[model samples]
Target chain A: MRRLGDRVGMAWAWGSSLCLLLGLGTLLVVLVTRGAPAVGPGLLFGDTAPGDAVLGRAPVFDGIWPALMGTLALVALACLVAVPIGVASGIYLAEIAPRRRRALLDIGVDMLAGVPSVVMGLFGFGLILLMRRTLAPSATTGLWLSALCIALLVLPYLIRTTQTALDALPESLRLVGPGLGFTRWQNLRHVLLPAAGRGILGGVMLAVGRAAEDTAVIMLTGAVWNAGLPAGLGEKFEALSFRIYVLAAEYRDDMQLAQGFACAFALLLLTCGLLASAHLLQRSLERRWKA
Target chain B: MSPTSGRTRGERTAELLLAGAAAVSAAAVLGILVFLAILAAPAWQGAAHVFTWDWRPFHGHYGILPMVVGSLLLALTALLLALPVAIGIAAFAHGLGPRRLARIVLAAVHAMTGIPTIVYAFVSAMLLVPFVREVFVHGSGYSLLSAALVLSVLILPTIVLVVHAHWHSMGKELERTCAALGIPRGRAVLRVLLPLSRRGLLTAAVLGFARALGDTMIALLLSGNAAQVPGSALDGFRTLTAHIALVVATDTQDAAYASIFAAGLILLLVAAAASLTARRLGAGNGRTEAARAAPR
Candidate 1:
């Protein structure tokens, strides 16, 4: 009877695991099959042309060049803003924070992670609207507001990951550094940070992937569907994620709709590729540390 | 002679700076909460008419009662569908599978954590909606059922990961002892493991609920954009998140916009409360574990 029960439990477990795999697999296959046939150099590089209106027309197959460019710019600016502050906070939490303060910081990060994306978008809109009304009436308000919102959204994740990496280091390393007469700052810069470099990079990459996929905040701030390409920070620009939302929601053109799918497919591929590379880098670093 | 004194000074300075930075982050989180409260203050001050079931954003009627009901119903339905499946998967990964297979399953579950919610919304809009509509024959493709189904998939990864962590954290001795007692494996697991992990399971459920509640894209894309109370699963409805997205997208600047802010505030409160409850449950469970360990 005991053995039979174990068998039943085992069967249930494997069955459920298979179900999860099937769910994700189905999603990936659906996206790929629908979007892959549309991918080509023309679809990748061309701008959305107005002439392709008929059913057989190539379906506004403009490459996602502008959306992709905007995403890159937004993500780059967000990373620039988030990484240093997140790392510095992580350093504080891991090495310098008192116990009570560390506890508070952990809770704060968790709460930040749990806040809904829409709220963030609302916050960005309200803050940016005020800033725009007071300061520059230029288009840069949306861009900078979106960037800052994304930076805040990603900050907690990076800080959490970096703190975990730093915590994983052996006490002997810290002792050795101080024994060698290195100051605390020098020890952190030269020894501790380098040791945790791969983990920190992994965290940053994860944050970047998150920033890349987000639409709600970008929709509220930077996104202006069908806008011409942006010339400056103030200019309204479309993003890949936001465009996917727009094409699927507001547009009636099926070809333009397919373009949205293609953009989504591209974004997914880019994110997955980056994640895979980061995993490889982490593994290599682990091997080096062991050696 | 003064080496220890100098090191202490530097450490103190670092600690002070770290405390200040952490306080800032905490303040940011609190500021969001405060902002939501202030935004919602107007609706609270308004007459009882605002609480009416009808949500006519075109008029001054900013009643969010229907939106709240829709959001709760959608999230609750998703949670009910997902909880059993997630627990079964977590149990299997931690206890039932072969060691190597378990690792692979766990990795896949973790990978699901990284997939963006918007992708889930997209897939549901493209595939699940059609599948449901075809099967139902009478209902529209975008219904509460479709939204719930999409959200179920979105929340599954989170549920599995949290419960799996709980299962793995149990001591091997507990399992071995139960097996040695000649108890049936399933009964032993029910009596021992499940009770021990009850708090963790509850935490997972609450967290999943919070996630489902907060999701905007799936609800927006699949709930049919109708501001109706769903009498049946096949009926169309609009959620708070979806309402905010739709309202903001149109750039409305009437009482409707203020109502959107009210909805956003409600969402923030729900999320915060859910998280706080989960954290407290987790802390209580930790104390129990420590108490259990103390006797031995």
Candidate 2:
């Protein structure tokens, strides 16, 4: 009877694993089939200029250049903001923070990470957007506000990753730094960070992927739909993810929807590439450390 | 330790600056709370619309009970559907699968976690919606059921990864004892491992539930945007995330905008409570490695 129960449980486990594979397979196939046809040079580099709207005929083509640029710019700025802070906080937690402070920081990061994207958007609109408009109406372009929100969105993840990376270092290295008569901060900077550079890079990659894919926060922060490139930091921008939302929600035509799919494919490719590299880097670093 | 020593001074500055940067995380939480509190103040004054269930923003009646219920229905249903399957995957990877297969499965799950929410949105709206409509002639494809399915898929990777971490941290004592007793590995997993990691399972469920509830893309694109309480899984509904995303964009500087902030406040409260409860449960679980991985 025990053997029979084990057999059934084993079967159930295998069945469920199959289900997992199937779910992933289905998503890939669906995305590929629908999104592949829309990929072309026109969709890649073509401007968002509605040719027909400008020339008094139906628009000939719509491209993802402006949206793609918006996403890349947001990712770049968010990485610039989040990577440093996240690494610092992670180092503090890993090395300098007292135990009680560590727990406090952990809970704070967790809560911030858990806050929904839309809620972050609301926070952005109410606090940054409103404050900017009130303080200096010229700063109400929404670019900086959205970038800051995306930074917040990815900050917790980077911090956690950094913490794990720093913690994974051999304990002997901790003493090695201090043995050289280095202060706590110098010890970390010269010894710890260099040792954890690959790990930190992985974390930055994840943050980049995360910031690029966020739509709700961008939507509230004046990410224009099908607009030209943002002229300045204080100007409105567009993003690939918001374009997906706009095309899906508003445009029912096959052409417009196909454009959305192309954008999805692009976003998916970029996210997958970054995330895969992070995974590879983590694995390679782990193997090297073990060796 | 000399005041004029450049190295010492630089080190001290670095520590102080990083500590200040670390403080930004806590400050962010406080900022969200304070600003949301200030914005949601108007809805607290016993507005007549606050007590109702309908949401006719044009006429300015904004009772968000429907959105509240819609969001709950989607999240809870997704949790219910995903929990069993995700736990099963975790068990397979840690308990039953061969080493090579487990590695592959783990890699796939890691990749899945990184997939953007919007990709899930696009896939579900394009494929799952049509499939559901064709399979069930009685209802539209963009119903609560479709939303739940897509969200379950999106969040399953979170559960599996968390549970896998927990399972790995459980150590080899159980398997060794099974070898001594003549019990099979499968039975030990079903009876021993499953019973042991109950708290981790609960954490996984809460985390995944919060994720589903907070998602805007799926709710916006696949849930049909119907701002009413769904009568059944086959019916359509609008979630608070979707409501805030749509309403906040168009309804600026009005009571409706304030009401949407009120909805965001509620969402913030739910997500905070969920994550807090999971953290509390993780503390009780006594596995720090698993707890760290459980936050997604």
Candidate 3:
């Protein structure tokens, strides 16, 4: 009876794992076969024309050049906002924070990370409302608002990764700076940072992939349709993730639905590329640093 | 000069700036909570009806009980769907599979974490929706079951990653011990490893539930947004996340807009509670906390 029970448990494990892998395989195959053909210069760089409109007056199909650029811009802006603050805070926490405060600070960061993206979006929307009342009388949801929210959204990832990376460094390197009469700032800038650069970059790549694909925050913070390329930080923008949602949810025909799949494929390709490179970068850096 | 006793202006300035950054990072959490509270103040005017079942904002009814039910139901169902697979994958990676298979399985799980929620929703919208609609012979393909199915795939990585991380911290000592004692592999895993890692499993489930509850796209696109308590898996229902998304898109005035704020507040509280519970459960297990904190 005991042997039989053991056999059942082991069989269950193998069976479920096989099912999961098979499901994933099927998903990848469907996405690739259906979406691969839509990957072309025409799809990447062209505009959504009036002819592409199905049921609505506005076009339903998108070529995604504008969205591609918007995603890149949003990610760049978010990185600009997140990296410095996150890295600085990380440096403070890892190197200088009091032991007691460190625990409190860590919990704060964790709770912030746990906040749902939609709540973040609501916060961004509230910020826009606050801005309209005070800072910018003409304030509206747009690139800057989305970028700011996404920055906050990804900040915890950067901080945690930065702290972990710095903490992982050998004590010898940490001591070399002080032993050589270097100040704290000099030690961090010259010795600690360079060593942890690859790891921090890996974190940034992960954060970028996250920011690019985040739809809920952007949906409330100014993702719009046929907005064209954003001319300034205050203008609304398009994104592939949002585009994919709109197309899939609102598509009128099979062709439009196919375009949605294409958008998904494009996003998958971009994020997967980043993930692969980040993984490789971390691996190579580990080998070089350890050797 | 010792590192701790530094008196240089540059060092002092750097420390102050870095500390300020940390302060700002920490304060942002409180700031979001306060802002949402302020935004949701209007809905509190209808506080009595807030807990009631009627939710038609246009008709002046402001209850959110249905959305609450929908969100909970969808998350619970998704957790039920994903839990077995999560445990199985963890066990297989632990030792039930070949070394090459383990490596491949781990890599696939890692990659799955990177896939966007939108991709899952899109695939489900295209494939699962039609299947559910046809097979169930119920409401249009968009139902709680459809959303739950898609969401199971979405939250799979969270549970698997946490459990796997906990097992790693457990190490191979137990396996070796059981083997040396002449215990069979499967029975050892079932009796020893499974029982030992039960806390880790609970932590994983709580975290996965939080993730499932917070997801908007699957519920938005696949759940059909019927704004009612679902009687069955085939019934369409609205989750808080989806309700907020829908309201924000279509309405920005009147009670409906304010109701979304109320919804946002509920989401915030639930998320905070879930995280707190998971953290409490995972407190002593630093590896579990690290895995839970990792960006999904």
Candidate 4:
């Protein structure tokens, strides 16, 4: 009886993970079944256009090409702004900054990272509205505001990972660089950077995943429900997650619902791919740095 | 060389550039605070309409207390339900399972963290809603319960990963000692591992609570958008994040626009508190917290 009870208890321990597996498994199965019908040639190939008003849109269903492009643009713009700052801040925190000042700055970064996505959107709205009211009276929601918000969002993660990567290096490497007659700048550029490249790249990839799929920030910034591809700096744009959201909430009919699912699948696929690569690189960073 | 002694011009310039970039992050946070305060100034000074709980269509009582209470209730429900499951998974994956199985479970939790929040919202909107509606026999499945259910799942992966890491790092020695003394692994785990990592458990729960609190889409899609005082799990209720997301888009006028910022300020306070707690907990302990705090 005692042995049996112990066995049951051990089984219960493992069973804990079963609850999580089941919940996620159910979500995956439901989405696949519901969304699978919506995936086809036009879903990936064609551009998304407005329906109902035209009584006809496109023969190939005019998939989310525009939203896909918009998502790419959002991530690209965010990375372009944040990458340099993030990488630089990472090195500063890891190698150079004063300890007391770094602690205060770290708290600020953590707070920034913790701000909810919608609040970030609110900030972006205020930014554009402020510009509209004062500087550019005709200014509209645009790419720069969303990029800035997302860049802020992604900055903390990048900085953290890069710092971790740099701090993980052996003191011997730092000493060796100096002993070999390289200056501080040269040492960082040559030996230290090459060693930390995988980790920094992993962090960058994770930030890309974050900026690409962020809905709330982009929703209130530049993203539109169904607009033509964004043309200029201040022009409104469409995004995959936002498109899914508006469609899901409004819920016109079954066809629209199907389109929402397809967009979701595409969004999920993109983020998942990016995250998977980041995960592999994170593993490599851990393995290589330790070895 | 020390900072003041042998610093060359090239080194000084490079260091200054790096430090300037770091300053940009700090400035962004301060800028957000100042901007939010400026935008929210009108609401603080405005008419009392924005403070009422009876929200009506197009324009209604803008009182934010109901949404605040609703958000609190939803987060409480999710935390209460998720804590045990997360603890169980973490403990099991760290101790009870074989090495390969442990690796797989941890990987699964990590992958789940990366799933976009909108995908979860979509699933809940489609599947959880009607099921909840049928079970409760109330408003469509868009209820506090549904919101709680999805948010619980959303934060579970984070909590489990955090708690599991804590348990493995801090509790494993005790487990090994108990096993060598002829104790059952389960008893040892319950008695030794669980108690030893109380701080981690608390942090895990706190991080999970914050994530659930800030989540907008699950509540927005599943929680019936009913901006009123919540009655029960079956009743639909609005959350602060959801309310902001819903109203901020359309409320471009005077007090109403400022009211959204006021709502944002409340969220910022809560988020700031969470950040302080995370900072105290040390940087390396809560990887999932950062992941959960960001969008999706």
Instruction: Name the best candidate (by lDDT).
Output: 3
Where does candidate 4 stray beyond 4 Å?
Answer: A1-12, A45-61, B1-6, B46-49, B57-60, B171-176, B282-296
lDDT at A109, model 1:
67
- The list of candidate 1 runs beyond 4 A from truth reads A1-9, A47-61, A132-141, A251-254, A276-291, B1-4, B7-20, B47-49, B175-191, B284-296
Report the C-alpha displacement of residue B90, candidate 1, in angstroms: 0.9
- TM-score of each candidate? 0.88, 0.93, 0.93, 0.92
- Contacts from the true interface found in each model, as a fraction, amount to 0.41, 0.69, 0.67, 0.60
* Candidate 2 docking classification: medium
lDDT of 2 by residue, A1-291 (tens): 977877777787788888778877876776667777776656755543455333424322366766777788888888889889988888887888999998888888878888888888888888754665578655553688899888998888788778877877888778988888876667787888888888878888888988888899989887987556655677888788988988877776776777777778778889889888877776676776677
User: Over the stretch B41-128, how does candidate 4's per-residue lDDT look in tens digits?
Assistant: 8666646366667666456456787888988899889999888878777767766677677777777788887888898898778777
Assess each model's interface with DockQ, reporting 2 decimals per model: 0.34, 0.59, 0.61, 0.57
Which is the winner by lDDT between candidate 2 and candidate 4? 2
Model 2, C-alpha of A135: deviation from truth (Å): 3.1
Clashes of each: 4, 0, 0, 4
Please write out the lDDT profile of model 2 over residues B132-200, one tens digit for every residue.
999998688889999998888888887887777666667788788877898667667788888988887
Residues B119-216, candidate 3: write the lDDT tens digits. 99998898889988898887897898899989998898888888888877787898889999998766676788888988889988988998899999
Give the top-scoring candidate (DockQ): 3
Rank all candidate structures by their TM-score, best first, as comma-separated numbers: 3, 2, 4, 1
- For model 1, what is the error of residue B166's alpha carbon versus the real structure, in angstroms, after optimal superposition? 1.2
lDDT of 3: 0.82
lDDT per model vs. reference: 0.73, 0.79, 0.82, 0.78
State residue B70's C-alpha deviation in candidate 2, in Å: 0.7
State which docking tier applies to candidate 4: medium
